[model samples]
Target: MCGIVGYLGKHDTKAILLDGLKELEYRGYDSAGIAVLQAEEFSYFKAVGKLANLEAKTADFTTSGFAAGIGHTRWATHGKPTEINAHPHLGDASYVVHNGIIENYQELKNALISEGAHFLSQTDTEVIVHLFESLLNGGLKPFDAFRETVSRLKGAYAILLVTKQMPETIFFAKHGSPMIVGVNESDEKFFGSSDAALIGKCHRVIYLEDGQLGFVSRTGIHLEDAHAAAVVPHFASLPESKLSAQKEGFRFFMEKEIYEQSEVLSDTLIGRLAEDAILFDELNPSLLEGINEIKLCACGTSYHAALASSYLFERLGKIRTSVEIASELRYKEPLLCTDTLFVVISQSGETADTLETLKMAKAAGLKTLVVCNVDNSSMVREADAAILTRAGIEKGVASTKAFATQMAVLWMFSLYVAQTKDTIDAETLRKQIGLLREVPAVVRVHDDLHERIRRLSKRYLHGHGFFFIGRDIFFPLALEGALKLKEISYLHAEGYPSGEMKHGPIALADPELFTIALMPKNLLYDKTKSNVEELSARDATICAISDVPFEKADDFIPIAAHDHYMLEFFETMVVLQLLSMEIAIRLGNDVDMPRNLAKSVTVE
Candidate 1:
């Protein structure tokens, strides 16, 4: 994934573009660049590292004279993170910045070379500009050249192009990666990879849909289909404070987001339950009639959310459900039908694999429902229905509050669906909903565990392996806990069902190993406690997370002893996420932007 920003307005182009790039740097930070059009020429500057380096290099320039420009912060998929692969790929006649992959770039490069076109960088994006230049040389307009060039390319992309011939306007299109057009009170137009990039500058935005093209200028904004048919724009107000993108006072975005769980969970559950203490009204009976099967698709932490949903649906709703990784589901070509309802989960609805899976499921005639944190994402627009998680903006590469909030929404979705199908009685649903309302307060009790988790991290940094064991709904939390440790700390971690530990995972236990057991108080609590004893007997250092302390465990991180159906689900996750962040910090790692990982996966 990469970050892109384009502005056609009265402000200083370079200053505005750089500010936008800094706000969007969570998307990518391997390299940065900017291009501004003044008169009939494009002036460019680029660097091989963070945006700060590029800004230092261009500090002496006069960008106030230029009225239009585009900037990029690259993550480098097709090429290495070097100066040569940086964005703002320039041609003789135009400059282009792109996010996503070009699958047929090699073939296009070969054809362009045969046709006497020169190449400068080892990037698939360079081929795009070269192909556009070739079309312009054949006497095509800038808009027509972009359309023709895109018709010949294959794969996912959201690109912004600026031409010397059309210096007053910027052209952009989207197929996979996210792009949005914003209009300010001053009537200026702005475009960027995400709404956060243009928040304070422009409050009203039109999020681009797949296969849609747009032309933006200082005076107005226009959108069109791939074949040039006119289309309308949908505008939405920006969040209350543009400071949502700022870290405020925290050491890192991850830390700030970890503490935001209480407010976000409260917001997500607000206006959802009625005064009669029932679930929301949006999940009507018509949506659940004869829905025989559900396929949950997601990636990374969102995949863990789907697993949690599977457990809830089976236990409460008695429905047959299958959880699939979104990337694998697209290639496996699984069985899908009109009777199947596909539930796609993603923190950022622009996740490439999840979006692709949703497109394929829709094409197969299955009704799709999106569970996401962002309001106007591509998946929300394309899905038959959407349940928004009010977690606000999650800037961390490793998700904290978003993952917890996603589970909250999924739990509510399961309860709503069960009520709609008449599988669960009204009294049971009301009890569960009441418990859901208390989750935020329950999670707040674990806030004091931060220092304790940091102390626990020191013991596990040099340890060889980590084992997380849980029973019932806590199994998903165990898996997610292990994943976070492994993803950032580079430690070997495994999550297994407590009963399954005897099968194979027990062989690696030793005194140097750390075992995190999620012992939430449920029907399976006693069985999970026995599993902890098994690990302790093998000389494994035990860190037990539960409502009550166990004498056999080495350490106990106590949570609120709530017997609500979903309260333990949310509390255990809070402790796990805080533990992972502490472990990462102990290893001297960047908790917000992990190495080699972007906040959004916009490429396959």
Candidate 2:
């Protein structure tokens, strides 16, 4: 994934672009660069690692008088993470900053090489600039050349182009990747991959749809479709308040987001409970009327949330439910039964594979609903109905509040579906609602919890990986815990249903292998204890996270015992999140922007 931002205004172009890039730093990047039109010529700088390096490289080029500019924070896709392979890819008289892959770049590159076009970088993005340059040299007008270059390209992209031929305008194109453009109070046009990148800088934003190509000049935004037809622009009010890349008082975004879970969960539940019914006013009940089965699709943390929801859908809704990894489900040619409700979950709502899966389901005439955190994302627009997670901005690449909010939303959806299907009685509905309402208070854990976990983390740095095992819904929580550890700490970890350990996983259990067991007393308590004992018999060191204290554990992290299963889920989740975060912190890892991991999965 890469971050793209641009400016077409009379302000300090370099300063504004750099600020926007910082807003997007949470999106993992390997290299960064910026190109600005200064003194009738393009002045550009590129750096290999981090935005700070790029800033340092361009420190002396402080020209507040630039015409237009574009910057990119690139996560290497078609090239190594090298300075020369970074963005602001140059042509003869233009520069480009791009996100997403160009599938036919190699073929186009071979053709261009045969035509004697010189190439500088080993990135698919470089082909685009060269081709545009070639088209311009062939007597095409600047705008015509831009369109021709895009017409020759294949695969997903959200591109921003700055050319000397049109020094006042920043041309852009969107296919399958996400891009947004907006203007501030000064009539300055701005561009960003996500609205978060332009939140504080812009007054209103226009989300560009696929195949829409246009430019933003001092006049205004000029957008058009592939057939050269003018399309009416849709603008979203720029949201107000704290989406800045501020960790508040915490050391990192992950820690801050973890601490924000209580409020995040409460916000997600607001207006969700009205009288006795679990009301989702946005969704038409007709979609669920004939739904015989539920299919939950997502990737990574969202996948774990979906898997956890699968258990709840079955247990509470009395419905047949299945979880599909979005990436795999796309290639598998999954059966799209019309009677099934297709639910897609994504934090960014722009996860490439998940978006494609949702598209496929729609093509097959299936009713689709998206559970997403970001409003106005691709999936939200594509799906028939959407439920916003209300998690605010999750800048942490490892994801903290996003997962919790997604779980909260899915849990509510399950209850709504249960009531609609007549599978839940009045008493059960009230009890579930009461438990749902109590989530904000239950997740408030032990005061000494973080300090104690910090001390416990020191003992786990050299373990032979970890086995985060649980049962039922906790099995997915186990998966989430392991994912958090491996994504941030670079340690090896695997999650399994505790009972499935002896089938094969238990063989590798040794004194060095650690097991973070989720043995909630409210659900399958005795069975979880039995599984922990089995691992202990094999000398596996145990860090049991439980509401009820367990004497057999090598280390016990006590959580407040709750009568409801979801409350226990929230309590155990806080422990696992803290434990993984503290371990990564002790290992001196960059917990916010984990290595090789991006905040949003914008590319396949």
Candidate 3:
């Protein structure tokens, strides 16, 4: 993933671009660049490392009359992360910054070379600007050249371009990646790869649909679809709440997001509960009543959320449920029937593999439901029904609030299915709902526990490996915890069911190995503790995350006990997330951006 920001306005264009890039650096950090246009003058600056590097390069650059510009922070999908490979690639009379991959670049580059166009950098993005310049030289109009250039490309890309020919205009288009256009009261325009980059600058924004193009000038704006047909733009209001972007006194975004879980959980369940029943009116009871099986498909952290929901669907709804990673499911082509209900979960809702799988399920005539955080994401638009997690914006590459909100949404869906099928009694449902209401208060971290987890992080930061083990629904939590740690802390970690510890993972246990045990106060707690003891005997340092203290554990972090399994799952996840954050911070790692990772996975 990469970050892109462009502006067509009367302002300090360089300062605006830098500020926007700072807001969006969480999406990428490998390289940063900016190109600005003022009157007849053009300037470009680039760097190979963090946004700060580019800031230092542009420190003395003035933006007095600059009114148009584009900037990018790249995650390095294609060339090496060097200044030469950085974005804002310049052509004959234009410069461009891009996100997503240009799949057909080699073909286009060869043709451009044949046409006497010389290359400057080893990047697919350079081909785009050169192609545009060549087309304009061939007497094609600006819009026609852009449309033709897009027709020859074959992959996800969101690009912002500016040319000397169109000095006051900014051109932006996207195929599979996310883009938004924000307009202020002055008719000035802002565009970015995500809403986060435009949030504070403009209150009204338009989310660009796939295969759409827009051109912004001081005069007005123009939008068109893939076929070049003129289109009307719809704008939506954005949340200006300071909490959306500020650290709120926290040292890192991972820490602030971890603490935001309390509010995220409450927001997820807001209007979905009745006095004694869970409400999911989106699902037709008559349709789901006859469904015999449910399929949950997702990728990365969302896959773990689906794995945890598999247990809830089976136990509560009395339905046979299966969980499959989206990347693996397309090749498997598992059997499906009309009675099969397919559910896809994603935080960005634009995950390429998951969206592909969702399309395949729809083609097979199976009714589909999607649980996603972004409202108008491609997955939500294509599904038959949708459950919005309402997790707001998660900037951390290692997700925290999104996972918890997904769990909350899935739990409510399970209860709805059970009630619709008459598999659970009303009294039991009421009790569970009551306990869920108390989850927000229970998930808030205590001062003592926070400091204790912080202290425990230093011990394991230097460990050779880590193993996370849990039983029942907690098994998925174990996998998710391991993923968070490995992603942010750069440590090798694995998760396995407690009963499976002796099978293979136990053989890797040693003094330098660190083990995190998820022992929720459920019926499986005793068996999980027994697994921890087995690790202890091997000289492995055991850290137990549970409701009660574990005497055999080398370090213990207690989660508040909850009578219901769903609430227990919620609090257990919060503990592991905190531990992951603390360990990454202690290692002096970039907890938010992590190495070789992007906030959104928009390509295969």
Candidate 4:
């Protein structure tokens, strides 16, 4: 994943571009660069590693006046994170900054090389700028060259191009990636991959549809449809906030987001739930009418959420359900029936594989829904309906609140379906609703709980490997817990259905094997306890979470007893998040931005 920002504004162009790139830092990158068309001449600076390095390298660079500019923060995909592989690659007549992969770059590059074009960096993006120049050299006009260059690209990209000849203009295109264009009261223009970079900088913003392309000049913004027809764009008013990303006195963004889970859940649940009724103003009941079965697809944390929701849909709605990883789903010969409801979950809603799967489902005539956090994402615009998680700006590369809110929304959705199907009696429905009402309270971490986790985290910092084991719905909870630990702590971890541990994985269980058991007293507690006893018999160090005391637990964090599993799920999620964060902190790892992980995976 990468970030792209472009501007033609009255304010210092350097400041605006750098500000936008900083706002997109949460997306993750290893190298950064910016190119400016100032005083009718192009100048650029490139640096590997953080934006700070780029800032330091360009400290004495001039920015008093500028015609146009583009910037990029790159997460290396095609080459090493060297200055030579950074963005803002220049061609004979163009300067370009790009995000997303260019699949057929080698073929394009070979053709360019054969034409006496000089090559430098080992990046796929450099092929784009070369192709633009190549097209221009063959007698194409500026816009023609732009469109022609884009037509040949075989993969995803949101490209911003500035021609030395047309220094007064900024040309752009998007396909299978995100791009937002905006303008100020002064007629100054801005472009970003997300609203976070464009907020407060522009009065209004237009989220470009895939294949939307055009230019911005002194007169105004222009538009071109995917089919090359001129059209007018619909713009939305920008919200009033600087959209700052601070720790809020917490050690890291992950810690702040972990503690904010209570309020995050509150925002997601507001006006959407009652004692015995579920309300989704954005959804029409008619859309749920012909759903004969359910199939859920997602990747990473969202996949875990979908896996958990499948259990709910099957148990409560009496519907047969299946869960698949979105990447695999796209390649397989999937049985996407018209009567089957297809659902996808993503935090950014721009996850490349999930979005591709959505497209496949749409083409197959399957009714689709997206459970996502961003209201202005591609999936929201493309899916039949969406349940916005409203968790608000999770800056951590490893998700916390996003996962929690997703589970919350899916739980209510499952209940709503059960009610419509008459699968549950009044008492069971009321109990489910009441359990949801208790979620916000249970996820709030008390001082006692945090301290207990912090003290016990030291014991876990040196484990050879970890087993997060549970059964039933807790199986997915175990997956999430293990994923969190592996993501932040950089430790080898696996989640298994407690019984499955005895199959082959239990052979690895030893004194150095740390087992975090989800022994919630609400669902199948006795069976889970039996599983933990087996692990204990093998001399694996055990950490049990439940109200009841565990005879074999080396450490214990007592969760409040509940009849419904969701309540315990909420409580156990908090403990798992805290445990992972504390262990990462003890190891001196960066909890907010984990190594080799981007917050939003916008590229495949």
TM-score of each candidate structure, all chains considered together: 0.96, 0.98, 0.96, 0.98
lDDT of 1 by residue, 1-604 (tens): 7999998877798888999998888899999999999777778999987788999989997766547789999998988999878989988978999999999999999999999999888999999999999999999988889889888888988999999878888988888888988888787778889877887887788888888887887567778877788988888887547776667897788888888889889998998876334455555556666688888999999998899789988877778889999899989868887888899999989999999999999999888899999888989988988888889988988888889889888888887778767788778887787788787887673435777777866767877888988887778788999988887777889878898888878888898888999887764888888888888999998989888888878878877778763677777887888888888888898787777888888988
Q: Stretches of candidate 2 above 4 Å error? A: none
RMSD of 4: 1.3
Of 1 and 2, the candidate ahead on TM-score is 2
lDDT of each: 0.85, 0.89, 0.87, 0.89
Which pairs clash in model 2? none
Model 1 vs. true fold: TM: 0.96
Clashing residue pairs in candidate 3 (N, C-alpha, C atoms within 3 angstroms): none
List model 2 lDDT by residue over 375-476, tens digit each: 889999999999999998888898888999999899999999999989999998998998889988877655698788889889899967899999999999
Clashes in candidate 2: how many? Answer: 0
Per-residue lDDT of 430 in model 3: 91
Residue 560, model 2: lDDT of 78
Model 2 TM-score, all chains together: 0.98
